[model samples]
Target: MTKFSDFANTLQASDIAELLALTEKPEVISFAGGLPAPELFPIEEMKQVDQAIYEKEGRQAVQYGTTEGDVPLREEIAKRMKKSFFVDCEPKDIVVTTGSQQALFILSQILVNKDETIAMESPSYMGAIMAFDPVRPKYIEVPTDDKGIVPEELDAILAKDDSVRMIYVIPEFQNPTGITWPVERRKAFMDVINKYDVVVVEDDPYGEIRYDIEKLPSLKSMDTQGKVVFLGSFSKIFMPGLRLGWTIANPEIIDKFVKFKQAVDLGTSTFGQRQAAYYCQMFDMDAHIKEINALYAKRRDLMCESMKKYFPKECTFTYPQGGLFTWVTLPKELDAKELMPKCLEKDVAYVPGGIFYPNGGNGNHFRLNYSNMPEDRIVEGIKRLGEVLTEALAK
Candidate 1:
């Protein structure tokens, strides 16, 4: 029998999907997976990209491209990012990645070491945490409120520790939480980091999904000292199946990420990158996103109303303006993981909120994603969940 290394021992499987895998409960409406609605996909636009890809760039799209990424695709991504984030940027600052997941992997390689520590929000994105866990760094959970991470706490931590090299953040409509950091908070968060020597890996996958309001400025847009390395993905807006994303950073770090990617998989799929580029340029992105937002907004409205109608008054949840998840906190004594089996038995599944915390500590909370299911399913599922909870608490 071969023994595995200490590094492999540090990684554990994520429970998000495992809860869903237990049974195909017909009545199960899962908020376990942070999935986007398939109906929102602009399939017709993608078909255009498919045709254009073969007609215009078939040879290049199919063949091996440079590890740095295809130049034209990178340029398109950069241009769009600059307009969206309202920040000055150049094509040289971008590196197209296989998914935002790969961007996390490359960053883990570049910035994290076995002995170093990463400061991150409590109940942050699980996928990001899981991506960095295999590298085996000390995980420090920073305290964040509905407004976002407390600046004083972060400043105090940074002031006390010289060893803290990196801080991971999801500033816009964060996964599991669905809490967008207000502009003033983004300013304060940026202000504190500006004084410190630490680096911020800004995650912004859901920034563009705003339904009720205009988009907020990104951390990278406000970054003046070149201290922020921003990550973006096409997964939420377009389709996760494309597996396309990009990282924006200083030339120095972009070079390292590019080199790390070269050693990892050489480059993101040339076809995928080209496909996204085509979707952006040729498609009616504004009209497409409007339709997506309208659908998700309706779903969100239904869930909120259903939760209020069925859930106990003691249960409180965040009302997200955009993005997929609604973070719910039951009574302090009621454990979320403990509630899982009962909820599943009732055929309603949700992600236990503890997994999102880098240090694994949010036991009373659960995340509900309204992005994937139909409005009828959303209503029915929440009603079922309400009955289970109502019955359990009465015991």
Candidate 2:
């Protein structure tokens, strides 16, 4: 009774979504979603901003916008890029999309052909993999370390394969792993990427959420060859309900995105764009972000300390400097997927890490998010998780 095409057959349900479904249970303590703390959201400020937008420009806010996006929002985004990423760019070079997720999908449409290769970090963002699935690109996994992707490994891979059209990387507070790249590695990556003609998709939704380290320069900032396509999102820093994100690339590349986006959604939400622009213009966004960083830092420390106190010596996890997640690598003989039901029975939940891989074979790993739960929840959840992990190791 199914009428779905082969293209539909290629897609599978995401593990992130599955874990998020578990989060809705009242008794469950979920470390599964990489969601920002609801307490940090500027609800009162947003309410005021909404009132102001309608009071002044209600018609324009509700009306359809240009495919390129609202001029003021684009201009504001370009300014923020210069300060944060250290890149000198004009508003014309940016294309506003529904979310950075859409930017990924649009880029996949514009750049990939059937069966062409895309070099990715071994445990990359599952959302990006899902976005690129319909294109059916071949994947080559490049190894990563505590300092992000290993440049030499990437160099060796790209050197032999000219068929790779793109190298997708998440250098800043990367999803799942929560590992950040150092300046040396970022420069080294650029050195290798410049020699080749492939595009580098820099998906950085958590770049600004640092805990106790200096900010590293973005790969896009060092991209003299125009090989980096930077994807920026407000979902992590701002509210996810707004669904505003952008693509920063060369003007020519942005032109292609603009055209394709026209066919996709015509434009991102006009009211949301205007409301976001007004809020940024009137509020101290830096101060708001600083408050958020401070709160998440406390949660991260609590989770790490709890793990140290409770987890078995055989289990090791990353101590993230910033970002929402911590990647745990269990003993090789154990399977994270097989451990999930046991965790759920303990009234706790986490994402099994094997799903982060495009080809899906690494079963000894899993990802945990510290941003959603409060300090008490983080401590108790990790304690419960520790018990689960210890029991698994014993068996």
Candidate 3:
């Protein structure tokens, strides 16, 4: 028998993946996947960009490019970042990634060695948790409130423990919870980081998807000490199929990421990068995002309203200003993980909240994504989920 590397043992299958598989069933109304609506994908626009890139550049469009990513796309990303997030960086400071997902993996690779610590919110993005887990970092769940990660709590944790090297956060329309950090909290968070030697990974995938309020200034914008590494993605605002995202950091850090990225996949798809760049030049992304935001806002409103009507009085959920998901918290006696199959029986599915926690004890909460479904489906799914929850609460 051949012996397998111990690395394989560190990776456990994702429960979210298992839950999302229910989406394959036609009868299953799933809020489990944080997916953009298929109807909203810019198919015709992408077709034009694809043809233009191929016709204009020929083999160059498809050829293997630099590990740092396409210059044009990076410049475009830089411009948008400056205009929106208040962060300024040249194209050279950017490293294009296959997606923001790859950026997270790369950060884990570079920042975390065995037994090193990285702190994140108590119920953070599960995808990020999975990325960091394989590196075998000691996971610390920082306390968070409606405003975002508590600064004093983070300071206390960092002060007592020197093992912590990275602080990962999703301040704008944070995944699962749909919570955005207030400006004061963002400044306080940065002030705490400035006091320490820790690096902050600011993931901003949903920053542009706001429904009502204006987007807040990113932590990178407030970063004065160059301790912030920012990751942005087209996956939320633009189509995810393009798989284009970028990382912005100081040149020294970006250089290391470029070299590390070269070893991972050599480079991301050149054709994809060129096509995205062409599209960015030719199209109005902000206007397109407005259309997306309008669609999702309606769906979010419908879901929240339905939850209000259908869920038990004891149950509560977040009202997202802008983002794909809202967090649902049930009464303490209820277990969302156990309630899942019951909800599935009623042809509705959700991501039980336990998996979102790094250490995995919270089971009375769940996350519902309203972006993937139509308004009617969102209403119906929440209605069914509400029935399940009410029944569980009664029992």
Task: Give the winner by TM-score.
Answer: 3
**CA lDDT for candidate 3:** 0.89
Q: Write the per-residue lDDT of candidate 1 for residues 287-345, one digit (tens) a residue.
A: 77778888899999999999999998889999998988999998878888888989888
lDDT (Cα, tens digit) per residue for candidate 3, span 96-188:
899999999998898888899999997899989888877889899999999899999999999999999899999999998999998999999
Candidate 1 lDDT:
0.85
TM-score of each: 0.96, 0.97, 0.98
lDDT, model 2, position 333: 93
Q: Per-model C-alpha lDDT, please? A: 0.85, 0.89, 0.89
Error of 2 at 284 (Å): 0.2
| Candidate 2 weakest ten by summed lDDT | 11-20
Candidates' RMSD to native: 1.5, 1.4, 1.1
At residue 387, candidate 1 shows an lDDT of 91
Candidate 2 segments whose C-alpha is farther than 4 A from its true place: 12-20
Quote the RMSD, in angstroms, for model 2: 1.4
